[model samples]
Target: MRRVSAISWSLSVFLLSFFFHLLPLSIWSEPAEPTPAEWPPKFNALLFENSSGKLHVIDFWYDWSRGGSLRITQNQLAKLTYERSWDNGTSYLYPSEIHSPCWLMHIPPGILRPNWMEGAIYHGQQYVDGFLCNVWEKVGVVWYYEDAVTKTPVHWSWIPFPGEQSVHVITFNVGAVLEDVDKWEVPDYCFNNNNKLENDEEMKASAF
Candidate 1:
């Protein structure tokens, strides 16, 4: 009777070990990070920017096919300005308003694509601006957050010298292209200026 009982106990233990080994590995492993969704070829968004306490509202238009981006900004003083970047390694800033004589400088395009975030370190989920977001950090230079459900960008922040600046997407409209083509035309004065303007630190932070 004792010998029979010992054999039964050993069999039970072996069966338990086999069952555990057959369980899926995922049960004990961390979930894989999700890939970020690609931005639409043509889209626009209303952005609220907070740069070390200074605030601005921006109407941002992005057109990958045209290889250009336009940012129309209204600063705290209710003054309007424009900044346009082209793939041709040039950017123009109309400091005062549209049609204003703009300052031209060399600035490469910094638009984000899906693959750009491929190697970014995922930080899991967090709440940002009242929305639950999946966050990723890239090269310790910037933190990007996307809405967990919609996959739309919620916010992004970068550290520039002296401070960190953040931009939040107030509204995003995909497949929305600027109807006014003339809005993208570079003012003649922009090309006429012989001197190139130095890149602003704020502008550098806003890239990407």
Candidate 2:
């Protein structure tokens, strides 16, 4: 009887283990994986406000190309000064006729944000225009951006200046206009800016 009972217990245990092995492996506990390519591509255009009172539009990830060449139009050609090339070698900042509101200053290799465009504008120390019309372009696309910032007279420490020692630093001193951005016209089909790029983005740059 003892032998029989022991044999029965062993067989029961073995059968239980076999049944569990036949069960779907997922019955154990790992997290479900996320679907592939589920996230939609996105872009951003933000006008930031500082402690003082200025406004700034911070843009990230936009495509501006339309054709083999940049799809810039004749109407917008007047806005751009012209395109010129440098030696493409290591160089310094403050190059002549660069004609950009922000530029990458000469920076040594291996530095963070070295020799890259900044999110900045040359504002003012006077009680006047803080934003100025500079230039406009988005990445990965060929089109003209409108440099609509009005110039200001007072200078803020947070504001960016080309060839300044800082990198990617910018300013939006004491003339921030939230109402203006709300009305800016953006292209209706812009994947990033679902609204039209408002001309008013630069309207309040000079207004207090």
Candidate 3:
């Protein structure tokens, strides 16, 4: 069973967000302390992660307006699904995942921290999903694309090897427009525990 516990997924989200934002800190030789008022812009994204041969797909959504967030994770092999959100009093559709949204931080500038670009191979410009982007690559991480105009990371992956190599890719700016507010709601089906599915073969087989 390649099931990832909720704790692990929550930790991955935190760690990935940290790595993405840390580029800015590394770019500046000497950076001034960041303040809450200067937080980065709010946007939604779709994160695709491939660990070894297993796959995990996440529909990641965020909005700074009300500090709202929605994350839907699907485990391809196990057929497990879970959702975590922070809209009305922070909640989770399944106990597997927790509501931890404070860990993700957005930094200003939104460009590749040049200092970390050492030995990074620039593949020039290319189109990804209809958007033109500048590509770059380095071991353990690959910059699939960066928005040509905004210079923001559109597609990238982190290949961290714990036991076997795990590839984590994040696709930013998914929906052309911000998602509907109600989309963040806990579906009525999830209101009752009867619909909850555990990460077991039997449950997984019938959940869908």
Candidate 4:
């Protein structure tokens, strides 16, 4: 009877060890590092932004190959504004109501490439904007979040030298291009001012 009891206990221990070894590696390993999905070459998105306590709703159009990005925004006061940035380091800001003169500036490229977040430091995962996201920080200037399951961007915050701005992506339409070619053309009024922003100054400005 004693020998039988000892054999039973040894068998139980061996069975437990075997079961544990059979478990998936993912169960025991650390969570994998997060990789941000590349932005499509041409896409459109609606963005909600909070910039230094000011709120804005923006209709954003991006065309990487053309090296142009257009942002049409309605501010909290319901005033409409348009901003256009190009790869040649030119940007135009105009108001729809013509209350203010259009402003043009020469600066670095205001748009980033698809692999902008490549090699960014992954800060692990968290719940942001009600979605489970894999977070990453790029060059200590931007915090980017992408949904873990869908791999779509959920939120991103820019911490520049002067202030911080957070942008929430309301909607993203991949492969969607703006059909209106005329929208990419800068208004003639913008060339009137011909202002230029230094590289350092560009850092203080928003880049999307």
The top-ranked prediction according to TM-score is 1
Taking every candidate in turn, the Cα RMSD to the unseen true structure, in Å, is 4.4, 18.8, 22.7, 5.0
Return the TM-score for candidate 2, rounded to 2 decimals.
0.23
Please give me the total number of clashing residue pairs in predicted model 2: 36
**Model 1 over residues 55-171: C-alpha lDDT tens digits?**
899999988888878998888775577888876777777765434456667755454443666778888999999999999998898899999999999999988777888999999
Please list the C-alpha lDDT of all candidates, in the order they appear: 0.81, 0.27, 0.52, 0.84
Task: Write the candidate numbers in order of decreasing lDDT.
Answer: 4, 1, 3, 2
TM-score against truth, every candidate: 0.78, 0.23, 0.38, 0.77
| lDDT value, residue 46 of candidate 3 | 67
Q: Write the per-residue lDDT of candidate 4 for residues 45-84, one digit (tens) a residue.
A: 9999998787999999988998889999988876688889
Off by over 4 Å in 1: 1-29, 96-99, 199-208
lDDT digits (tens) for residues 70-167 of candidate 3: 66667785544445444344444442333311121122333233234455676778787677877766764545456677766556555554434333
Ordering by TM-score: 1, 4, 3, 2
Deviating ranges (above 4 Å) for candidate 2: 24-39, 43-208
